[model samples]
Target: MQIIKAVYINEMFKISKKKKICTSLIFLLLSVIVAAIVVYSLNNFAGVSVTGSSEFSVMVLTILSYSLFPLFTAFICIDMFAGEFADHTIKFTLTGPASRLNVFLGKILAIATFIASNLIVVAVLSFLFSLFLNGGISNPLRIIISYIMAFLPIFIFALTVVLISNFSRGTTSAFMFSIFVFLVFVGLSVAFPQIKSFLFTSSFDWYKLILGSYINVGKIFRIFLILLGYGLMLFAAGYYLFEKKDI
Candidate 1:
């Protein structure tokens, strides 16, 4: 436990020093600003009265989750795993007292932490912007729940990226492969609606299941179980590859 904690802190410190972290923040902020601008333009020029703060926040969340969130998650996972392996810097950590499993867990935890922080920032910024524009938010609790629930599917996506990174020999290859797999899954989900519920990609909008007025607990629980299964399997496979790889 202590070893994992130490490695988690060290990984976070390393991530903090990377320019990618700053770039992610800038991208998120720009996304919110762009969304706000679009809303403003639509209301003034197009004569569209978009006056729901909660709705605006949901719009931003949906866009980010489907686009930037997965891209950044892949970037971070590749850098942490594949990049380290390619650069041969992973040897330094492997030589330490901590076991490979501990190191892997720590890095995974760090990535999860950074992603959660990014989501929180996006939620806060979008909410504040919407509040300023629309005067007040309706159903703040639902918006909050939507953002919170988003983390689960995103984290599961991270696990998939981690597994991909383990199979990659370099950062570039890892990133390319991750994106290809992501697109493939998305395409598959669209091509075959029957199997959509089983795909992790379909769960990206899992939050919406709760957002609707109906609130089907059975469906939500089923999806949650699917995500949990994917996460566990991916984590185990990633760790197995990492353990066997020559660092």
Candidate 2:
């Protein structure tokens, strides 16, 4: 337990020194700025007063969650997982007192914490920025609920990228493969639009389940199960590969 804790701490320290603070701040700023612009433009020129509407909040949340957040998470995970491996830096950590499982768990924890924290910040900042723009959140509870549901997809994305990173030879290859997979998912969704619920990317807007007049408990549960299952599978595969690979 102590060794695992030490691994986690060391992983965090390494990530901190990489100075992701600037990138996170930029993301937060971009989300708020773009959302505010969209809201302003809609209200002024389009004769649409989306200010404080459930729809407005949903729109912002959907854009942030479904698009930007996932892509951002992929880059971050690639950096933490594949980039370090490609650079031959992860070997030093592998030589620590921590076992492979401990090191894996530590890396996972660090990545998860970083991604979750950024998402939380984006959620809060988007809400507050909307409020400042007089685009009040119609149902603050719904916003909270949506953000909660959003976490699962983010986790699933991180795990999938981690798996790819572990399998790929270099960071560039890992990143390209990740993009290819993302594109493939998008293509599949387009090809079989009806079966989107079963697709992980389909749940990028899972928050929409909570935004409507009628909450679909069955659909929500199904989405939850799908994401959870994918996360577990990806984690298992990534761990197996990481554990067996000679660093």
Against the true structure, whose TM-score is highest? 1
132-238 in candidate 2: lDDT tens per residue?
76646667888788777778887888899999999898888887898888778878998999987788987888888877889999988988988989988999999
Q: lDDT by residue for model 1 over 28-124, one digit each (tens)?
A: 9998998899898987799886644337888888889999999999899999999999999999899999999999999999999988999999999
Off by over 4 Å in 1: 49-54
Task: After the best TM-score superposition of candidate 1, give how far the Cα of residue 188 lies from its true spot, in angstroms.
Answer: 0.7
Give me the candidate number with maximum lDDT.
Answer: 1
Instruction: Single out the weakest 10-residue window by summed lDDT for candidate 1.
Output: 47-56
Q: What TM-score would every model get versus the actual structure?
A: 0.97, 0.92
